[model samples]
Target: MKLLALDTSSEGCSAALWLDGQITERFELAPRGHTRLLMPMVRELLAERGLKPSDLDALAFARGPGSFTGVRIATGVIQGFAWGLDLPVVPVSSLAAVALSAMEQHQLADGSGVAVAFDARMSEVYWATFACRDGLPAMQGNERVCHPENVSLPDPDTTTDGWFGAGQGWKFVDGMPEAIATRIRSIDTSLVPRASQVARLAIPAFHAGQAVPAEQAQPVYVRDEVTWKKLPGRE
Candidate 1:
């Protein structure tokens, strides 16, 4: 499956082209320059693979609970590119992408349940729990938007057999209970959601027939429910 993916959902801006079974990725830390840096990465990846946008099987991106501007930038770019080329698009969750990244770093198998958290700023974090089945994250619960202090380790009393914790948020907080921190087989803080990872995720979504049309494209802004302002309507 040939796919192109982009992620600007944090300080990182990354792009990738997945051709046949090989992957080519480019990433940089441009905290506020994604809008400018992203397209070039896209162009380079496409050119490197000797392919055009139309030759791509699908477009993928980081749909998020991270930066509001970053998520918009990613989805907007993804939509513009995918729609213009009339290709299918798949949106991967920023948190889930982190979990996937963690798995890749540790060489974990298909059954490792990963607990991932990204520093959401404002003393809060964007967190989620996921398990790998065939090297992909099958989230245990809905992604969460919560404060760090309010977040707790999953109950070993009920969830999966083993768990791992990763992402920046894991490092931000202090004194993680031993039960939680110790359970972690590995911690990869350098890992962040990247477009390349999202493209890798699209592989399954593509064969599963999960790609959505451009007009139906949406952002997963877990932090906001008030973006739709009180309209000029009965209030």
Candidate 2:
């Protein structure tokens, strides 16, 4: 199966094309130019593979739990492309993608769990946990947004094998509880969700008949509601 995927959900912007069983990707850590760079990156990958939007089996994207604008950008772009090509869309979780990256990059063995987190600004984080299954990270719990201090694991018994901490959120927080920290084998503060990883994760979902129409494709912003309090000197 062939698939095209893109992600602009963090400081990085990336596009990946999965043809046959091989993958081609373009990635850039551009914090401000996702809007300008995403399409070109997508086009470049397609061109390299001599494929078009209509030639792909499906389109996938990192759907959310990162920058609001970044998530919206990817959602809108994928929606438009899918609508135009009449193709199914797969929305992969950004946190899950991070976990997949950790698995591949760190060579975490099967059954290893990963605690994925992304700095969500405002002193909060977007976090989730996933266990490696068939070399893929399967989410263990709901993705969520909260202060680092409020973060906790599902259950010690369930995660006793421990999880590898991945993403920038772990860097922002002072530290996790001793129990949790001790369980973590290691932490990768430099990792961010990329399109290549999203596509890899989406392949199974795509084959499982999980794709949706363009209009039904939605971003998963864990923080559904935001409340703001005006500071004394600010509006």
Candidate 3:
């Protein structure tokens, strides 16, 4: 299937074209510049594939548990593109993409496990523990927003050790709770959701008749509703 996917859920903006199992993607860590970079990246990706918006079988994007503006930017762009072409769209979880990428990185087979987290920027982290199955991430615990201190490890008895962790969220955790620290033996600090991964992950959802309306393709901002005040140099 030919699919176009994009992600603007963090420090980077990324877009990709996936056709016949081949993938072409563009990504950059442009921070607040997502507004400027995203569309161009999408255009370039589509242009390289010699395809128009209508040629895509589906459109996919990272649907939050991330930056409010970033998630909105990603979903809004997907909405416009999908709506314009009258195409279906798949909304994949940003944090889920993070975990999937990590699982792929380690070649973790059906029995290994990993923890995924992302610094939520308001003194919290978006966290989930997954059991890696043939390199695919299957949730082994709950997905939630919690302070570093409140984070707990999943039951070790239910899964084997050689625990791996991924994402930038772990950096914010100074000294991990005793629950997670003892078993976490490896960590990959450089992983984040890329447009390529989002597209790859969305293939199943798109083919399974799981696509949603453009307006319903919204974000999953897990932080509290209280607006965070920032200084001129902040935010």
RMSD of each: 3.8, 5.9, 5.0
Q: lDDT per model, in order?
A: 0.79, 0.86, 0.80
Q: Considering summed lDDT, which 10 consecutive residues are worst modelled in model 2?
A: 226-235
Better of 1 and 2 by TM-score: 2
lDDT of 2 at 29: 96
Cα displacement (Å) at residue 25, model 3 = 0.7
Q: Judged by lDDT against the true structure, how good is candidate 1?
A: 0.79
Error of 3 at 142 (Å): 3.5
Candidate 2 backbone collisions, by pair: none
Q: Clashing pairs in model 1? A: none
TM-score of each model, in listed order: 0.89, 0.92, 0.90
Please provide, for model 3 over 128-147, each residue's C-alpha lDDT reduced to its tens digit, 9 standing for 90 to 100: 88877655677776678988
Q: Let me know the TM-score candidate 2 reaches against the reference structure.
A: 0.92
Misplaced by over 4 Å in model 2 are: 226-235
